[model samples]
Target chain A: MAYPLPVANVRLKNLTKQFDGVTAVDGVDLDVADREFMILLGPSGCGKSTLLRMIAGLEDPTEGEVYIGETMVNDVLPKDRDVAMVFQSYALYPHKTVQANIEFPLKVRKVDKVERAKSALAAAESLGLGEYMSRKPGALSGGQRQRVALARAIVRKPAVFCMDEPLSNLDAKLRGETRAELIALHQRLESTFIYVTHDQVEAMTMGNRIAVMSRGKIEQVGTPQDVYDRPASVFIAQFVGTPPMNILPAGSIETGKHLVGVRPEHVHISPEGSLAMTVTLVEQLGHELLVTGRVGERRVVVRQPAHSVVPEIGAEVRIVADAADLHRFDPVTELRIDI
Target chain B: MAIDQIRGGRKIGRYVLLVVMAAIVLFPIYVMVIGALKPGNKVLVNPLLPSNVTFSTITRAWRSGHLARALVNSSIVALVVTTAQVITSVMAAYAFVFLKFPGRTVVFVLFLATLLVPLEATLTVNRRTMQSLGWLNSYKGLTVPFLATAFGIFMIRQVFLTIPKEMREAASMDGLGHIGFLREVAVPLSRPTIGALALFAFLTSWNQYLWPVLITTNSDYNTVQTGIAALQRASLSQPNLVIAGTVIIALPIFVVLISFQRQLVRGLTAGAVKG
Candidate 1:
C-alpha cells in the first residue's frame, strides 16, 4: 500500500483562545510547511496543547484564522478539517479490539467492511501489531496501546497529524524506541506533523523545526542547533538545554551592562579562570559528571567528561568559558544581545 | 502452634455465624415453599414439614387464578417498561453529562426534585389523566407512567460521568455525531450500569400492586400481583393456593436476579474504586 504525500501546509495567524477570562493561547502566529515535522515545545501551562487542539479543531479559537493549505477553517468541524490527532491518553475504545480501534475512523466514514478490514490489517501489520489485533487495549502494554493509537491516526491518512504528548505514558526505554519509530513514520508518511510536548529532547530530535512557547506566546522558532547555539531569548537559552544555560551577572564575566549566558558543557574548571565558586555537589552520570557550584547567590552546573579529574565537594574552583562561546542578553527585556 | 489453633477457632466461629444468619433469612421462604406443596387441609398440620408433597395445589391455583394470562401480561408490561426506562435514562443522562445548554444544572435539579414527590401524591392525578385519555384496563396505562424515571436518570448519569471527556473528543474527531457516539461508544461502555438498571426496572414494574389494582378493573389485564390478590380473596379457605401463586410469581424475579447478579454488584460499586 502506497501512502499519498500531503501537499497541505498549516498556517495559524494571530490565533488566540480564552477560557472564561484567562487567555490560554494568546496571539500566536506560526506556519508548518508541507511535509515538515514541527514540534510545539513548552512547559506545562504554556498552552502548547491548547494550540495543537485548536489546530485540530477540537477547540474553537476565540480569535484568529487557521489555514490548511489555502482554505481558512475557523468554522470547520474536526472531521472536516482533514486532520487526525493522537491524544496523550491514546483514547482507544476500551471495548473494541485493536483491529476494530484502527478501523473505527474508516467505519465512521461508511467505508465498506472489506476495505476497512484490509486497511486496518495493513496499518496494524505496519505498526507490528498484527498478532495483537484481537486484544483489547486493557490487555496491551503501554507502548502497544500507544502504537495502536498511532495506527489509528495513520489508517485514515489525514493531511495533517496533531500529536499531544503521545509518548508521555510510555517507559523511558520504550519512549526512546518509539521516538525513533515516530521519526521514521513521519518520513514514510510524508505528511505535515504538528507535535506538542514539553520534552525538549523530543523536539530537538524529531522536529525539522521547534517552536518554543512560553506563557501562551511563541518565544522562538528555529532548528534544533539554531535554538541551541543561538537562543533568541533568555527563556529559550534556559529552556532548550538539559541542565539549562548558566545565567550569571554581567560583572562575573566581561565588563558589560548585560547578563551572560553559557552552556554547561562550555563552563570548565581551570586554575587561571576568573569566576570563582564553591563546589556543592557532583553527580556521576556513568559517562559524565555534573558539577554544581554556588557563585555569590546563584547556582551553576558544569558538565565534565567522566575521564576528567573529579572535583571535591566544598572545594573552591574557578570556572571559565571562552569569549566566543558566551551569549549576552539584556537584563531588562531578557532578549539576546548580538554584540 | 497456638496461633494456628486460635485462627481455626475464629474461622469456625465465622462459619457458624454465617449459617445462623442464612437460616434466619431463608426460614420464611422455606415455610412458603413447604406450605405451597402441601394440600390445603395439611397446611396447618406441621407447616414446617414437607410431608404430603403434591403439585395439585399449584396446578389448581394456576387454572383457577387465570395466572398464565396474567404472567404473559405482566411480562409484556415489565419488558416494555424496562426497555423504555433504559433508553430514556441513557438519553437523558447523556444530555445531562455531555450537552451544553442554558440552565442545565437547574433542569437537572428540577428532574431530581421529581424524585422527592412520593408516588402516592401523584396517583390520583395520574389515574384521572389516564381515565381522560381512555387508557384504563390497557397496557398503556400500566406502563406509560413509569417509562421514564428520575431515579434511573440520576443513577445512569453518575455512571456516565465516569467516561472521560477525551473519549467524546476522540469520537468527534472520528466523525461521529452525538447519536452515533451514543450508540457505538456511550451505550456500550455503560452496559453494566444499564444492565443493573434494566433488572431494577423489571423487578419494580413486576412487583407493582397498588397502581395496577387501582387502574385495572378488567380480568384480561390482570398482572401477577393483581391475580395473586384475587386468588387470595377467592380461596380464603384454601390458603395454600395463594402461597403457590406467590411462589410462581417469584420464579421470574429469582431467575433475573441470578443472571444479573454480577452486573448489579459491579454497577452499584462502579465508582467506589478509581483505577
Candidate 2:
C-alpha cells in the first residue's frame, strides 16, 4: 500500500433509529477515540447492532448525525465512509476462493491486479491463511473462514472496523485464540474498532472503553474497570458480572437509600458480620465457591476462595459488606445515588 | 443372515420397480425413434420395430418442412428470451429484496399476482399489443413479450431473500454498493437457481406452439414447433415424413435437457428446496 489509511475517531451525536413506529436506538451519544477498541455491550434488542449499523451507514438514522474524523457522515454512503465490517456469519462470498475473497475489497477499489494479489497474499500470510488461499469458504472450517473475513477487512486498511459479534460463531477455544489475534491486529493497525457483542467477558477483556446499553438507551460508558467498579445505573451493576450483583432493599444499615447493591465477590461470610443469611445452595468451582442464601427476604450470593471455610446448605451464616463495596441506587430511577 | 436376506430382497424389488418405471417413461420416445427410422410404405407394418432403417424420409421431411430455417428462428427466440429473462429477473428480484420504498409490499404483491393469470389468459391481449407495436412476424414478436417473466421474478426473489441481510451491509462497508454486491455476491450465490431459471425460459420459449401459430403469418418466421405441425398436415399421404419431423423437433429439447439436467430439475423445484 502506498499510504496507510488515516485513523479516524468516531462520534455519534443524539443518534436515534426507529423501525415502523417503535424506537430501536434512542438518543445515543458516543465518542470513540482514534485507535480505541470500543465495545457496545448489551443484550439482544438493546439496539447495539442497530447503533453500529447506523455508524456504518447500513441503517438510516431517524434523527441526529454520525461523524467520522471531522466529517458528518450521516448522509455519506457506506462505501464512501471508508469503514469495513465483519459479519457474524463470516458472510464470505461462498463462490469465491479465499484468495479472491481477500482480494475483493481491493478489486472493488479498482486496485491493479499485481498490487491486489500482493496485498492479499500479505494479509493471508499474516493470518496464517497462506495454505488455504485457493479453497472456497465452504471447504474451510468455521475458524478458517473467520480468518478469511479478517483478511478481507484488513486488506484495504479501512479507517474504521465495525464488527458485529464476529467471534460469536466460533467455538469457545477458537474464540479465545481469535480474540488474541484481534488484539494484536488492533495494535498493529492502530485504527478505531467498534465491536458489538452481548458477552460481558468479551467486552471486559477486549474493549478499552465499554458502553453498556439496555432498552434502546446507553446506561453508562467507561473503561472496563470503571464500569465494573462504579456502575452508573443498576442495570450495569447487574448486567456486567457472572451471577451479577445482588441488589436488595437498603435495610437498617443506615444507607439512606431505597436500594443497595454488592457484587458476589464483595459479599463475604464472617463470624462478626452484621447480616445473617441461611445458605440454600452451593456452587463449587475449583478456585472459588459461590454460596447463595437469603438475608431476610432478599437472596444474595457470596464468593469465597477455596481455602476459606465454606458454609454447608441448610446452615446459617453471617454476611458482611465493606461500606466501600456497597452501591446505593434510587429505587424509582434505578440510577446510582452517589453516597 | 435373515437381515441380509431382507435387505437383498428389498434391493431386488427396488431394481424391478425402477426398470418398470423407466420402460413406461421411455415408451413414447421408442415409438418416435422407430417410426422415424421406418420407410413410408412399411410404417404401419411393424410399428414397434425398426423394420427398415432409412434416412430418405428424414431428409425429405427436413427439406419440405423447411425445418432448418424453423430451427434457426426457434433458437434465436429461445436464446434471446432466456438471456433477457435472466437479466431482467435478477434486477427485479434484487430491487424487491434489497431496496426499500413506500408501497413495496403492494408492488410485490401486484407483480406476483401476474403469476396467477395463466399465460393463455394473457395471450390474446399480449398478441394485440405486439401487433399494434408492429412486431408481427418478426423476432421481436417472438422474443419481446417474453423478455421478462413473473415466475422468474418469484423464483429468483425467493433465492435472494435467503441471503443474510448482513452480507449486503458488509458489502456496503467494504466500499461496494448495491450494484457491486449483487454482481459479486448475490448472483454468484444464487447460481443454481439462475441456471434453473435459464433452462426453464429456454425450454418454454423453444416449445411454444400456440404463440408462434398466432404471431407468425410468414413461413420465414415459423418456429420448429409450428413447422412440425405443418408437416403433419402437408404429409397426410407421407406419415413417415411427419414422424421424422416430430423427431427432429424433439432432438434439441432432449439435448438441452440432457446437458442441463441438474439445472432443469433445480428450476422446476426451485422454491421447494434450499440451496
Candidate 3:
C-alpha cells in the first residue's frame, strides 16, 4: 500500500478494550477517512460501541493505539478529544432547551454567547431544527430530539462525530427519516463520521464505508456493495443481509471448491438445474417473492422479483444462479475463494 | 376509558377502597392540625378540625418559646447541610460511576457497605471522632459527620448509573472537564432524579432530630427540631404552646413539600426503581 495524501480522520491500530478478565474488544484495526461516513456494523457485544467510545476517549484502550489526526490519544480525557457523540437514546440535556444543549460545548470551551448561538443556530438549521430551537428535548418529537442531538454534536465543527445508534429510539418510519437526515448532514459537514448500529439496513444505506464487526474483531471493511457482493467470510455473508444468506453443506466436497451463494433476488425458478430441492414455505413480499425450502437436511431460500410468475409453495421447482454469482469458500476455512 | 366502562359491584368496591385509603392518609394529619390549634383544655377532645383556631397561640408560641430563632437556625442548617450533602454525593457518585482508579471499585463497595453497618451502631465511635476534631457545638460538628451520607451517595450513584456512557463521552468530546461535564450534561440529563434527591436531602436534614439534639446543647444554637423538643422538656405541662410551636416548626417543610411535591414523588420512585 502506498501513502495517500489525505490525512486519515481517525486511525485505530489494534485497539482493544478488556473488562475484568473478558476481552470485550479484541485486537481491531480501522481507518476512517476524512469526511467519510463510516459505520461500525455488528451485533450487540461485538465491541462496536466500545470502539466508538474509545475514539471519543470515554474508554481507555487496554491495548493498542488510537489516533485523531497525527496525535496518539491513548491517555487523553474524552473532553479534550475534539470529538462529538450522539447516543442511541439521543441523550439530550433534557433540562436545557435545544439552544442551550447545542451551546454547551462552546460554553465549556469558553466560547462567548454570541458565537455559541451563531454556530448552534447553523447546526440546528442544518438538521432542520430551526423552528424548534427553543424547545426542550422532552417537548420535541423523537425525530426532532435526534436532530437536536445531531445539531449539538456538529455545532463545535468537530473533527469527528461519533454516533451510537442515534436513530434506535425512534419509531420505524422516523428511523428511516432521521437516517436520511444523518447522511445529508454528514455530506454538508464533511467531517469524519463513525456510526454504530446492529441493523445492517442502516449500515448498507448510510455508510460510505462499513466495517463489519463480530465478536470483537473486524470481519470485513468495505463499501456497502463491496461487503454485500464479496463478503470476506461466512459470518459476514450471513450477517449482512435480511433473511440472511442461506448456507448449505455443499452437494459434494469437490463442488465445495466453488461454493454456492444466491441472493434472494438472484434465486429464481430455473426450468433446468443440477440440484434437487423440496419447497416448505412461501413468502410473498409486495416487491418480491421468497421461496424457503429444504435441499436434503439443509434449508435453502430463493427470492424472486415481484409480480413475476413464481412457483407455488407445494411446487418443487428447479432453481439456479449464474456462475459468477455463486460464491466459493474453502470448505475448512470458510474464507472466500477468489475466482 | 376502560376503567370507566368497568361498571358494577367491583367498581363500587374500588370507590370504597379509594375513600378508605384517602381517609387513612388524611386523618392523622387532620388530628395534628386540630391538636395544634385547640385551646389547652380542648386538646383532649381530638376534634376533627380546629375550634377557636385563632392565630394567638401560634403568635405566642412563635415569640415566647424562641420558636422563631429555632426556625431560623434549622433553615440555615438544613440549607447548608442539604447543599453540602447533595453536592458531595453527586461528586462522589460521579467519581464512583465514571472515573477509574486503583482500588476504585473496592472503595465504592466499602462506601456502600457502610449502609449495612447501621449508623446507630457506630454512633459511639463517630461521636468520639467528631469530639477529637474539636467540632462539638459547631455547624461542622452538626454537618460534617452527616456528609458523605450513605443514602445520598446511594441515590445519586444509582441515577448516575443509568446515564448511558455516551453522554459522558459527548461531554468530554466537547472538551468539558469532569466537573464541567457533570454540571453541563450528566447533571442536567439526570435533573429529575437529582431534583428528587435534593428535596430528599433537604427533608432528611430538616427533619433530623436525634443528631442535632445530641450535638447542640445551647438553646440558641438549636435546630428548630431539637429546639422544639427542648422547649417541650422546659415546659412539660404546656401542651397547647408546644403544639403551636410544632405547627410553626412544621410550616417551612410544608411549604417545601407543597412546592417540590412532584420531585419528592419522582425522587422517591426513581430511587426505588434504580435499587
Taking the candidates one at a time, how many backbone clashes does each contain?
Answer: 0, 0, 4
- The lDDT for every candidate, in the order shown, is 0.94, 0.90, 0.80
Q: After superposition, how far is residue B33 of candidate 3 from its true place, in Å?
A: 6.8
lDDT of 1 by residue, A208-309 (tens): 999999999999999999999999999999999999999998788889889999999999999988999899999999999999999898889999999888
Best by lDDT: 1
Measured with C-alpha atoms, the lDDT of residue A3 in candidate 2 is 28
Name model 2 segments beyond 4 Å from true: A1-3, A252-255, B268-275
lDDT of 1 at A161: 95
Query: Candidate 3's interface RMSD, please?
Result: 2.2
Superposed model 3: Cα runs more than 4 Å off: A1-8, A242-258, B1-69, B102-143, B188-248, B251-259, B271-275
How does residue A278 of candidate 3 score in lDDT?
80
Clashing pairs in 3: A78-B172, A79-B172, A79-B175, A259-A328
How well does candidate 3 reproduce the true complex, by DockQ? 0.60
Decreasing TM-score order of the candidates? 1, 2, 3
Residue lDDT tens for model 2, A1-339: 222767999999999999998999999999999989999999999999999989888899999899999999988998898888888999888888999999988998899999999999998988899999999999998899999999999998889999999999999999999998888888888889999999998999999999999989998999999999999988899999998999988664444756899999988898898888999999889899999998878889899998777778889998888888989888899899886
User: What are the per-residue Cα lDDT tens digits for candidate 1 across B34-61?
Assistant: 9999988998999998999999989999
- Cα-based lDDT at residue A278, candidate 1: 97
True-structure lDDT of candidate 1? 0.94
